[model samples]
Target: SQTIHQWPATLVQPVGSPLSLECTVEGTSNPNLYWYRQAAGRGLQLLFYSVGIGQISSEVPQNLSASRPQDRQFILSSKKLLLSDSGFYLCAWSPLGGRQPQHFGDGTRLSIL
Candidate 1:
């Protein structure tokens, strides 16, 4: 089983500021890493996914970008933050074949100040 860990449980940033959120998976190799965001009552939106190092897939055209630095380490970053970007950010990991359930981290609650 893989355990995902996300940092900075909560964050408050001013508009136009930069943001970086990280997620790491332990106990797994070559896992699929994912970044997701959830609004107040909306469903989870997939932001990015990585199948291997240096390979990233974006689901939307926003001010955010994701990177897979290591095989089990994934990062989410933005050069400029926006008010609409405030939400609960999450990181998840699953097996490569898409047959297993994903394990999510505690998540980070981001608020635009």
Candidate 2:
């Protein structure tokens, strides 16, 4: 069975500070990994996606970046967080080339102060 883990379930940071969030998957290999952010009352917006190791696609250019350092580890980072950066950050995974429903870990809810 495949499972995903993401942490610091919630965070409060001052504006202009740096941010780093991590996600990892177990029981799967070379799965498609995605980072999404959901603002208050808005739909999930794709931030980045990785098809394989060292391969990432950015869906938006904002105050955020993503990286895949291992087969199952994905990271989201920001150099200087903005108040607009505060939201629900989610990590999801799907089987390679299959239509399996994407599974999400408990999201990181960030609030900028």
Candidate 3:
């Protein structure tokens, strides 16, 4: 089956604490990966994207950052957490050159206290 991996599925973090979220894609080769954040009543915000290994582009100037550590692995991290950073984090992948539609994994719900 096609699958995308993301964790932790839920996170409760104190303000100012560090944060790390990981995502990996399976059953696909060299997919274009994307990181997105969805807040209540808001549209999906594209945070980062990678078309190839180590080729990352940021779409927003938020406090979060993303990295492509491997061909199928992506990591989102922050040295300090903020209340505004809390949201549903989604990891999605699509075939390159916009040939196919994107698919998303179960998102990680993050809350800051």
| Candidate 1 similarity to native, TM-score | 0.97
- What lDDT does model 1 reach? 0.94
Q: How far in Å is the alpha carbon of 35 misplaced in model 1?
A: 0.3
Lowest lDDT block of 10, candidate 1: 93-102
Q: Which model is ahead, 1 or 3, in terms of lDDT? A: 1
User: Which pairs, if any, clash in model 3?
Assistant: none
Q: Name the lDDT of candidate 2.
A: 0.95
What digit string (tens of lDDT, one per residue) describes model 1 on residues 1-113?
A: 55789998999999999999999999989998899999999899999999899999999999999999899999999999999999999999999976789999999999998
Q: Candidates' TM-scores?
A: 0.97, 0.96, 0.95
Give the range where candidate 3 is weakest over 10 consecutive residues by summed lDDT: 96-105
- Tens digits of per-residue lDDT for model 3, 1-72: 668999989999999999999999998888999999999888999999999998999999988889998989
Residue 69 deviation, candidate 1, in Å? 0.6
As for lDDT, the candidate ahead, 2 or 3, is 2
Each model's lDDT comes to 0.94, 0.95, 0.92
Misplaced by over 4 Å in model 1 are none
Residues 1-113 of candidate 2: C-alpha lDDT, one tens digit per residue: 88999998999999999999999999999999999999989999999999999999999989899999999999999999999999999999999974778999999999999
